[model samples]
Target: MACGPEGDFARSCVPSITTSGHRVTLLTDDGVRIEAAHTPRIPGPEGPYAPSRAPFPAPSADLAVVLAHGFSGSLERPALRRTAAALSQHADVITFSFRGHGGSGGRSTVGDREIHDLTAAVRWARSLGHRTIATVGFSMGGSVVLRQAALHGRRAAVAGPGEHGERTDAWPDAVVAVSAPARWYYRGTAPMRRLHWVVTRPTGRLVSRLGLRTRIHPEEWAAIPLSPTEAVPLIAPTPLLLVHGDRDPYFPVDHPRMLWAAADPATAELWLEPGFGHAENAAGPELLDRIGRWIARRARRTD
Candidate 1:
């Protein structure tokens, strides 16, 4: 049930401060500039999208998590920082941008191509010596993480099942999706429809024209390998967790509710907050504690 060697590289942990001890750089892969940064707990948060600290010396800090931001958002969100701060005890964490969002390359694939970006980042995380990785995603980032799990499986094999075609030994032992939209295509959506129109037409067009690929992927990306909703089944038996607020208006809890319902009973979980929204953990401690505990439980399971 554990991830393979690839998973071992990703499960390493080191305490990191978002502000300092980190420097931003870009790694090139297949002609793409993946924005990357590294920080130690000594360096604290300075600017937006700066990376979090890895557990120093790796594999020594106990555990680690990788955090991906929501659409139109960066790692600077207060909810994220607060949660990261609280979860620091579990492992060293990393926060990253998707392709064009924040400080990365390419344009958003609307959860289409960014999954590639997430996969590549995980590869990088695994290489750093992580053992049990817990992917915590918000909104679209949540979708990206889920898609990565469903499609490519986990980069690390020591953590969980990595049965996807790649057959990596390492994989994420635990997965958390917060306020994530389960079925985007099934939409008779008002907000997403309106939001889609806004981004795809004027905003998307404007940014696309400017050569700025933010949330929407460029037209050149004609074929995508998978859809976020399609990858739901593959996450089973991997300790999948879903958290959403009742008041979440972005993509109704009904979506995540359905996701939890559809997920494999043996490997999935859902937590619906009474008055949370798109991301209530942004300002709340209780949610952070819940997330931390889930991550800790998964890491200890391997121990």
Candidate 2:
């Protein structure tokens, strides 16, 4: 098993770190193809460490972490790669590009249909024989994680109907959302206002395509889908961590506060870091390692 330099598989484990990760193409329920990379964890000579908190049990050896990038970001992005490198120290890492971001098919629905993309990634992680899986999302990807968790919970809650058969096999074990917006269509901040223009205006869309290399769908949202605040309550019983920078330029502190309020305090943990920016950019090596340990601790829990 080969691995990257910063990856745990590199040191004291494998002799030569040549060919490491494999590519996985997941077809979402909506028929969109998502490109993903699966980097399996390589155990070191030291073995797994016990959790700092006793509440969480020791995680399984087959634990996996799925990384979801923000808008205009992909698996190849430097920020995402840095995050993956840090997380790779604790567990196996899986990174993917949401639709319209990288090599994935279909235009970005911003946060609406992107749930399919996340679901597909989680499902793919499970298919690889990983008993425990954790999802970590940044920015737009963060909203997608919340919605995906809620969608799975909603399905499980309403599994009696004809179309809504039981989908217990589809849900992830843990979730982390960084710099996610609690409400939709928020134009409070200047950055958000500019982002809205880029997403809603024709000239901005053209610039997004040519300059950012991201394709946004022309169709408008029919109705406000379940907002992140609305979705948080449904994610109860599943471990959730909401991380936000107090200095985020896009969404203010209120966004994370709203999400924290909506989520069940018993199962949710919120981290409001000072002087941090937004998403992957703000997540430094120490922060990423801390996040990795947080997820690893929960992933180990059997109850």
My TM-score estimates for the predictions, one after another, are: 0.76, 0.86
lDDT at 113, model 2: 83
For model 2, residues 49-125, the per-residue Cα lDDT tens digits are 53223221233447889898999998878899889888988888888898998888899889988887887777667
Give each prediction's root-mean-square deviation over alpha carbons: 7.1, 8.0
After superposition, which runs of candidate 1 have C-alpha atoms over 4 Å from their true positions? 1-21, 24-30, 37-61, 77-79, 154-170, 186-189, 207-215, 280-283
Judged by TM-score, which candidate is best?
A: 2
Candidate-wise lDDT, in order: 0.62, 0.79
Question: How do the residues 37-102 of candidate 1 rate in per-residue lDDT, one tens digit apiece?
Answer: 333322235522234444233333245677777776555546666666666645666666767676
lDDT of 1: 0.62
State the weakest 10-residue window (summed lDDT) of model 2. Answer: 9-18
